[model samples]
Target: MTELGYRHGEQHTPPPARRVTDVAVERFEHVFEVDPRLMTVHVAQQLFPNWDTLRIAAGRADHLDWMHRHWAHTVVSGQELLDDITGADADGPPGGP
Candidate 1:
């Protein structure tokens, strides 16, 4: 028989734990209608760093689609969307349409 130390077929070995985060990352492609996956994640993090990844992904899908439909443009830049929708100038922050 093989030595017990580092032997094959160890019953004590534990299975790898599943992670929701990894699933979210894999499912991240669903956001393609918004923009590039990595770019969208980066911009989202910048806008809401404290947000959960799942929340961000869902919010992005809703917010981007809403803005695209209402504003009549595909936007990757949050600030640009804000400025355009709110009619804000380069020097001013967005307020309203």
Candidate 2:
């Protein structure tokens, strides 16, 4: 038996680690009612018709880093987009419009 418990002499390769792209795709699907199996490149193209696949992939890491920083800053800075979307202003009471 192989280390992965396959029959003798068989080869096995593990799946790749989940990328930030996968999380983005999952979120897009959940929020936009897109098909779960739709590829990330398709989603990007739909959102940004001018962007090519290679350019999208190349910016993934930098975009993720920027998002992380934005989220961290939002946590410290208080409500911004979410507040505006929900109609809850900083001067208004909690959950108020």
TM-score of each: 0.26, 0.21
Q: State how far residue 86 of model 2 sits from its true place (Å).
A: 35
Residue by residue across 1-97, what tens digits does model 1's lDDT show?
A: 8655543333233233333452332323343222224456446523222224446678877996887889975546878777675665654655534
lDDT of each: 0.48, 0.44
Once superposed on the true structure, which residue ranges of model 2 sit more than 4 Å away at CA? 1-51, 73-97
Q: Scored by Cα lDDT, where does model 2 land?
A: 0.44
Error of 2 at 90 (Å): 43
Error of 2 at 37 (Å): 10
Over the stretch 38-87, how does candidate 2's per-residue lDDT look in tens digits? 55655552433222333555587578678888875544334665766566
